[model samples]
Target chain A: MLLLRIASTHVRNRLRQTIVSTLGVALGVGFSVAMASLMEGSQRDFMTTLIEAIPHVEILDEKRNPAEQPATALYDAVAFHGLRPLEDLRGIRNPTEAIASLREWIDGDFAQRLSGQSVLRYSGQDIGMTLVGVVPGRELKVSKIREDMRAGSFEALDATANGLVIGRKAAERLGAELGDTVTLTSANGIAKRFKIVGLFHTGITTSDEGLAYAPLKAVQILLEKPDIINSISVRLADINDATRIAARAERQLGYKAVSWEEANEGLMEAFVVRNAIMYTVVGAILVVAGFGIFNIVSTIVHEKARDIAILKSLGFPETDIQQIFVLEGLVIGVLGAIAGCGLGFGLSSYLATVKFEVTTDIEMTRLPIHFSYVHYVLACLLALFSSGIAGLIPARKAAKLNPVDIIRGAT
Target chain B: MIAAQPQTGTDTSPLLQTRKLTRILPAVVPVTLVQDVDFSVGTSEFVAITGPSGSGKSSLLYLLGLLDRPTSGEVLIEGCGTADLSSAEMASMRLAKIGFVFQFHFLLPEFTALENIMIPMQKLGRLSAHAQLEHATGLLVDLGLEDFLHRRPAQLSGGQRQRVAVARALANSPDLILADEPTGSLDSAATEQVFESLQAIVETQKTTVVAVTHDMDLAGRMQRRVHLVDGRIDYDRVQS
Candidate 1:
């Protein structure tokens, strides 16, 4: 208690230096927290955007391993050429039954889809595009296409027997509009007539110009792959269950499944690297703040040489002397951490309100800041650790001071 | 003074004894500050160590106070050898049984006189906070500085500061008090006040007093004197 008293008295006597050093630590902690919030905020924004535009989990008709002939498997160095097999459709054979079985455990909406390359001919204009077939009512629950529609309703596909929806750009190139009858001829030469029921603008070049949608059963028959669906799109209530659900679904259904995170692997890797760099920068700033503590503590030890000698002569041991200076550093560090957390909250909140729309051409958004207690806890721990070491060096020096040497001249 | 004559206690062992103590600076050129010196003082005996500049009076007192270790030989408190004790143990012994007063008062500039006097007792940790306060207040009253208890060292005059330093020295009620020119920096009036205060402690409290002084007039008043010349004892004799 006496040592604490002595340390606090020393700090109180040097008010200006104490304030300056504490502010140095405060600035370091405050800025690091704000930077962390900003960086984490942007990463979260990108994830939400990616998750919104696609299914949380997509189970495809593709196999994890490619089909190989028996001869190819038997020979390691030699390849077997041209063994043609009978035509058999590659798709989930009983789509409704499989979906019904999966729905017993997983809580989500599921939609069946069939897709293929096709040529659309309307009034003599022809355009090549990918035609995707879907059950209109169920598809809307699993995809964001409902929001992209510029004209006609997704529900109208249920009423109209041969309804189709095409993007705004694709319909323009084919010279077709809502209510126009068009002919879609698949790659295998089977043709069908469908009336355009809806138009959409997705802001994606490929999808807007080269994609069309029709009722699933109609496309299944037109492609000559009756009673088969190539893919199942799932939108779970909790997005975090995507990976586990996708893995279980793939194992059970014997099809390759992909989660949203797996689809954006490269972008997620970039985020990890960004986070590592951010933490390093914040740690370096705290270390620099530690130097400020080291400087002020060293000055106190130098200035209080006589007082140290006097204490030594009063029968205080070297360990007690060491403790006093270290305590001083801790006191300053604690005060600075409290002040820094307050400042960070204020700065981050102010940042969160600023409209950060770079240009009107893109979506308008506010500057993002993720506020969490973890950030404050981490910053304070770093500040305290650094200052504790900072205070120790001078304290050791002060403890080793020879009282006889200092008091000789004064006596 | 105070109706008590100069007499050494008849205990079998001296309160403080030195066996050929020596100290060397051990610098690049190696200065020998205090050569082999044998000394002893009994309980209730007031002894003065007088020498000219650099004659090792202060050096000898520092060795006796355990502020400096002797290069050879040893110091004994209650006839127990201090050579093998750890520095921490020595510090503990000093806190429990010895006190020091310097020429400059050396009171911490931030603490008041009463708080300064309470420091040694607080370090010893043998008394409660309330008891420490009461004892510190009682020491100031005995030294006639009751009005100056709340004043810092800087606020007090030279004599007042030295008396506060004296009260601090007595905080733990040690067996022996060592003063290195306790009145050297004061004027005639303040010097007389501090001298009488030390004399009162020796007479009323029976605490042994050992002082290092350049002022012969003050040295001559003690019951015994040890004269040192070039770190060697020239004489150790009683005033009678």
Candidate 2:
């Protein structure tokens, strides 16, 4: 108690020194908090866009490698005695059962779908595309296509027997408009005229120009494989649980279930590197502030040699003297951390309101700032630890001070 | 390097004893500050160490108060040798059994007179805060500083501050009070006041008091005197 009293008195008496040290720590911590918020906010925005734009898990037919097609037999069997006719193979069998199994595994929702590469011819222009056949209601529950729609609706596609929902860029490239009919040709050369009933814009080049959605039954009819689907898209209650649930679903359903994280491993690795850099840069600032604290504390200890001697002469041990100075530094750090938290929150909120479009599919038009209490708490603890260490060096110096030397010099 | 054995629980034994005490300033060329000097003081004794500047009078007092360790031999407090004590142990030993008053008052300027007096008692931690306050208050009151208890050192006169320092020294009620030129910075009138306060404390509390002073008049008032010259005791005598 006496040490604290003494320490507080010294701090109160030396207002300028205390303020300088406190401000040093405050600026460092404040900057760290702001950076933390920015990084966290950006990470959150990226994750949200990722989760919203795609299925958390997709269970595809394990036997089909979408990248390869089954080769056709070169020689056609002649109509001869004892020659058997080749049977036509469909997509994943028992789609309803697979969909039900996936729905049971996923907490939120799931969709059964079929996908095939095709070409759409609009007037004189033709473009390569991957057409996904989705049930409109279930697709809406599983993906953010509904939210990203720039024109028309999924219900329109559902109602129109030969309707297509195409991206804005695809519509532009194909010169297709709502109510206009486009010639869609399946990979097997089966062709049909489908109306462009809706358009969506996700601002992602890959999705915008290469993806088209149509009604499931209509696509099956165009492909001449009715009621057959190749994949199940599942949305989970917790996006983070996708990997584990996907693993379990793959095991139980005998389908290859790919989690979003597994699909975006490269992006996740990049994010990890980015976060490491962000924390390192911000953590350096706090370390610099710690050095400032160390400098000030050292100066104070040098200045207080006489006082230290006097206390020592009064029978105060080295530990007591050390505690006093250490307490002083800790007090400064704690107060600075509190002030920085407030400043950081204010800065983060202000920065969050600054609108700017990132030239990416981040789905945000404002600076993202996730003001997590965890970040604030972590920043404060770091500041405290650093400043405590800073204080300790000088406190040890004060403790090791020779009272006789100081007193002898004073006299 | 033989350590002296400590004698315990004996009345009428000298309260402090220094046997063949020597101190050398360890340096490139070592200089002896005090050499093989033997000294002792009894209970209720008012002794003055008189010497010219650089005669190592303050060094001897520091050695006696356990502020400095002797290069050889031992200084015993209440018949207990302090030769092998750790720094912390020596500090506690000083805190419990010895007090020091420096020439400059050294009354930590940040604290009030009351707070300054409470420092040693608080460090000793034998008394509760309430009791410490009571004892600190009583010490200041005894020093006739009842009115200036809440004032800082800067607000007090030189004499008042030195008296506060004396009060601080007595906070733990030690057996011996060591003052290194306690009245060296004061005017004659303030000097007498400090001297009388210390005198009354010694007579009433029966605590042994050892002081280093250049003032022959003050030294004459002590019951005993040990005069130092060039790091050695030139004379030791009793005043009749």
The CAPRI-style docking tier of model 1 reads medium
Q: Enumerate the candidates' DockQ scores in order.
A: 0.67, 0.84
CAPRI-style grade of the A/B interface in model 2:
high
Tens digits of per-residue lDDT, candidate 2, A162-212, equal 999999899988777888999999988999989888999988888889999
Q: For residues B166-239, what per-residue lDDT tens digits would candidate 1 score against the true structure?
A: 99999999999999999999999999999999999999999999999988998999999999999989999898
Model 2 gets an lDDT of: 0.88
Q: Across residues A63-168, which tens digit of lDDT does each residue of candidate 1 receive? A: 7887665677788699556877545569988999989988998899999999988999988988897888899989999988889899997778888879989988
Which residue runs does candidate 1 get wrong by more than 4 Å?
A68-88, A118-130, A147-152, A160-212, A221-224, A358-362, B1-11
Tell me, by lDDT, which candidate is best.
1
Q: What TM-score does each of the candidates earn?
A: 0.90, 0.92
Show pairs that collide, candidate 2.
none
Error of 1 at B94 (Å): 2.6
TM-score of chain A considered alone, across all candidate predictions: 0.85, 0.89
